[model samples]
Target: MIGEGVAVRIIPCLDVRGGRVVKGVKFRDHVDMGDILERAAAYRDQGADELVFYDITASPEGRSVDVAWVERVAEAIDIPFTVAGGIRDVARARAVLHAGADKISVNSPALARPDLVAELADAFGSQCVVIGIDSIRENGRYRLRANTGDPDNMTDPDLDTRAWVERVQALGAGEIVLNCMDADGVRSGYDIDQLADVRGICDVPLIASGGAGTPEHFLDVFRRADVDGALAATVFHSGQIEIPDLKRWLGEQGVRTRTGSVAS
Candidate 1:
């Protein structure tokens, strides 16, 4: 059961490609937003509980994350942040952490080798290992897809979504970022039913990503799915929803959230 006093975190996601923040619908047609450091600092001051940075092209291009940018972001923001993309081994994960990232997220590589989760957890403790699962609903069933949900990487026909979540938890993952590919940038609302299903099997903190368009959406996900955090990229990046205001709205509706400036 989720703790009653744990505040629901509001997180901003920055999807970077070639070192610039980008936003797109369902992981296609990405448009550059702005300088990564500028956006990171803006969100931190806006009261975001944490930030998520993903090098959108790293997995597809077959390379590791650029530690240089991670270091810059670490210097720019005082809040905790997670770095993802092409983090496949313990050594690479160590480098990112040493570069000042609070956590490292693994997706495509973890799908190919499940033991990597165990190895990371063993080396850095479960708290530092975050498993990012990009899922799509297919014919009434949720299926796992990787490589940022590219069709070419959708070759795992038998990978069950629920099973994968359960397996990762057993492997010692401390958190799960469930990115609903179908809802990636639509911003209608979160895939509540899907989040609830994943929430059922997830033991660690669950972060809901995709389809967050309004303050109500965040409230719904928290009340319906019992998620520990809500993450958004398009809404936050475009300034459609400000973190401080969103947190204030959630608070007005009786949701527990961190108020005022994020602690340095």
Candidate 2:
């Protein structure tokens, strides 16, 4: 943030469950907020550079691609969006893209196949692939978390976050959306140590998600590590922080951002 650098994006995340925007902490604090299209339009008008639509219910239900509603939100917003959760294959990825998503984010699918990322990237371009890696702090060290979506939880299926970051990049991942569920909806702050691990291992652009609760939280993440963007749900959705105010604060903190004329 101190020098000339790549623009750090203020990305908004919409964790959609049953056609409603929901806020949950470590995948636990599920709160039905509002309609997806309504929130997407508000953020687009509020100067959000991009949006991420996550089907938070996909995991528990065993289905994916909230295609109908995704299309609606995409049609309502001018900025691009990255859709994730339960996108298991290229065909499904294509369906979401056809629905108006600018990018496809796959977490469990890529890890299960490892080749899925390459296939999707080869099929659609690298920029269209965003791999979500959930990491958490544990036992005085940072570790990659699997399946739980809660950063604090861990299981034997876990892979080393940094090691997999390198592997995913080689597998043709264009960017990594590092999310720490422990910080999700907590409004505390991002996992700096965890973000540092991903930032250190990832060569492509990195997006830091989870733990953003205030305007100062945005500045804190970028200042602590080299990240391409910041993604938040509760704060932005609850009106605890506004995109325009976040950008202004980042600028004051020496972080460069898209200086567009905010529509709101």
Candidate 3:
């Protein structure tokens, strides 16, 4: 169960690729799910606490995020939604915010230029910035990828995940989204140990991403890691688990959550 005071957030991620929402395993083998605007509104109607719109292929394809598409989704959904991908500088971040996105999520660009985190926090307030760290455990240690960018451009420093979290927080990131590459789309459970380690290092809110298949998996993460929020894509898109049902079950388990209006 989550601790006293703060309510746990249930966020649904819409991994957009080429203007369409897609879901994949370990960020590969993606299948088109639906139109971005339609899915965003559906999640909001389903009582999602917040929606995350990730342009999954933006960086790899060397294209800026489709600001026009973002405008369309923002106009369609009443709830807060985050827009990410190819947000390389404050100008791009500003453009997304102007397009009506409530927040901007950054990955590899932040790793390559740590100053961007501080710059964004300084310009738009820390709350508007989310630092996403994607990791995979190997050789008894965790290595990170900023995001799936071109192989030639990606620099795998394989930095320690915990240390990296601390750095980002110090750089003024208001939230951390820890993505476990190994657990991503596997649907087994969240990376509890990994979340705990990152949580211990930073005082900022942590969102555990990847591997959320069952409602029980959420309960486990809340009880064990005490993450501020949980993010999933395939399960929600597949209709295997609905946000309202999950929140209701969580409430029954003594976890405080915002159930929104309750989906009819």
Q: Estimate each model's TM-score.
A: 0.94, 0.90, 0.93
Stronger candidate by TM-score (1 vs 3): 1
Error of 3 at 251 (Å): 0.4
Candidate 2 lDDT score at position 187: 79
* Worst-scoring 10-residue span by lDDT in model 2: 148-157
Residue-wise C-alpha lDDT for candidate 2, range 40-103, written one tens digit per residue: 8888888899999888767435588679987897787788899988888888989999998899
Candidate 3 lDDT, 1-264, residue by residue in tens? 434687888999988888898876544678888888788888888889898988878876667798999999888888888887989899999999999999999998898889999999999999999998988897888888765634445557668887788898999999999999788868999999988877788698899998998999999999899899999887898899988899999999988988656444
**Regions more than 4 Å wrong, model 2:** 1-5, 149-156
Preferred candidate (TM-score higher): 1 or 2: 1
Looking at model 1, residue 37 earns an lDDT score of 92
Identify the superior model by lDDT, candidate 2 or candidate 3: 3
Q: Please list the C-alpha lDDT of all candidates, in the order they appear.
A: 0.89, 0.81, 0.86
